[model samples]
Target: MKTTLKIAGALLAGWAGLAGAQPPAGDADIRHGRYLIQTSGCNDCHTAGYMQKNGQVPEAEWLTGDAMGWQGPWGTTYAANLRLLFQQVDEQAWLARARQPMRPPMPSPSLRAMSDADLKAIYRYVRSLGVKGSPAPAYVPPGGKVATPYFDFTPKNLPPMASQR
Candidate 1:
């Protein structure tokens, strides 16, 4: 009987230790997402002047979106304000969208590589920030113009080719 009690106590102690090793669900998810966002350079374009400021923007101001647009053969695309985005959609919708193809410079491939849990954590973290800022400017198709200043897409000058003759 004493041996059985000792064995039970050992199992209980082991269980408690395992529980203590893991962080509480909500907090852990949000924190992990925040870490990923910071390390993955999400703020570089999502937050205005992030690179210029060397990432000094406060957490509250991060992911608020920017007016700077990326221009290329595809079109001009703007960085989205993540806080507003999460508020506008549920987790499943966001995940579905994240899986879809995105415009130039948005790194959709990288997003697709993330696990569902990481995506959920990102959703939770952005939601926790609360909604702020207006939606980013609409995308401009190739050969179209945008209201905001954008990265100019210019083709390199080349000499005439003999093949044309």
Candidate 2:
């Protein structure tokens, strides 16, 4: 099931790259989506300058993806522009795609644990913001070249975990 969702997500993520039109949704649904997005810290990484600005970034710029890179044992991963990503995905696609694991810093486990309703709310909120900007830069595998600035996590000398007494 996991692999299936991953494959499906990959396909849908590429298949529908256009989502200017929004599905009809009630005010309550949109509100829930907005609430979920704000409270869940989605803007922390998804929106450029969000953290530096202390979450004061405008709603118009939310979920547009960021250029900042998180580099570590997994190489590098950029925050996906959810605004653009959700544009490509419909509600059903989001339900399945949301379950797939993403690279580091994505909190895939937290996303996977969310209820269907919560996921839908998140989707709705992002889509409501409308699509803007280009897709995030592609992933850079370990030992691969990276052009953008990144937060390096290459491990240095570190103490080992304490032995169980």
Q: Give the poorly placed runs of model 2, Cα more than 4 Å off.
A: 1-23, 161-165
Q: Could you list the CA RMSD of all candidates, in the order they appear? A: 6.2, 12.1
User: Could you give candidate 1's per-residue lDDT for residues 35-101 as a string of tens digits?
Assistant: 9899878899899889999999988899999999999888899999988988989888998998999
lDDT of 2: 0.87
Candidate 2, RMSD to the unseen true structure: 12.1
**What's the lDDT for all of these models?**
0.87, 0.87
Top-scoring candidate (TM-score)? 2
Tell me the deviation in Å of residue 23 in model 2. Answer: 9.4
